[model samples]
Target: MLGDDGAGPLLAEKMLANPLEHWHVIDGGSTPENVVHQIRQLKPSLLLIVDATEMGLMPGDIRFVDPDLIAELFLMNTHNMPLNFLIEQLRDDISEILFLGIQPDIVGFYYPMTDAVKKAVEQIYQALNLHYIQKAFEPLAICEQ
Candidate 1:
């Protein structure tokens, strides 16, 4: 995994500080080909990928990355493989796939994460807890027989 390319794992680290009751925080690193097998074993209802992806926006800008929009992204700072390629591998087993991409400021050795990206990480953590995760599960019905 590349240095700043560890964005998703880093974000997962910060979010795990308070620790959600039902969430499983995993740092799959930059290349998670094997992690896909683990995810398939667990069979979670939703799968969200958080990463540093340049989308031609401000350095700290965060956006919902669409699989179709992969080609248009500016991802020189990321690792060799495109995330959408990994997503495709999981598509057969994963019903819901969502991506949270943060634009990066720096992407090399020994450099601390940018203040802007840090703020975006905090914002995303709050957004996931306060809004999105709940909404994602709203449509599912529990059966009691």
Candidate 2:
């Protein structure tokens, strides 16, 4: 319910509506650590985490953050476990971990997402969907060559 803090969950809901094959979209909510077991069970090669972050940038700005810089960049600590710590726990299980950080305008409770953030979310959803669709067709394209 915290303003743009809902960015991650909103993205998760969008993803659930039209999921990609072989991809799992989990809404870790404010307690992402709780989903560690579920994530590990999937044995995914790549894990992409999307969350609202404080980057001292314009609202709606999105960046593909390096895991090492997470501690320095992540100012909001809404999650139960520190994001860096959670990453460390799953590093062994997941081959690649990606953090997509969206700069949030307001994080107050019961506030709705700002237009900038909402736009960013839609952009992210489209990009991911396009990427997966292209990937899904790769093998077929290669086979027909």
Which candidate number would show the highest lDDT if scored against the true structure? 2
Query: Model 2 reaches what TM-score against the true structure?
Result: 0.86
Error of 2 at 28 (Å): 0.4
- Badly placed stretches (over 4 Å) of model 1 are 1-4, 72-74, 133-145
Give lDDT: candidate 1, residue 136: 32
User: Which lDDT tens digits does candidate 2 get at residues 1-145?
Assistant: 8999889999999889978665689999998988999999999999988889776767988776677767764456578777998898999999899877788999898898999999888878887867742232111111111
Task: Work out how many backbone clashes candidate 1 has.
Answer: 0
lDDT of 1 at 46: 82
Cα lDDT of model 1 by residue, 1-145, tens digit: 3445567877788767877555667667766665877888878778887788765666777766566556544344354577777788888897888777777878787788878887777777877777564343221111200
Per-candidate TM-score against the hidden true structure = 0.80, 0.86
**Candidate 2, overall lDDT?**
0.79
Pairs with backbone N, CA or C atoms under 3 Å apart (clashes), candidate 2: none
lDDT of model 1, residue 143:
23
- Give the range where candidate 1 is weakest over 10 consecutive residues by summed lDDT: 136-145
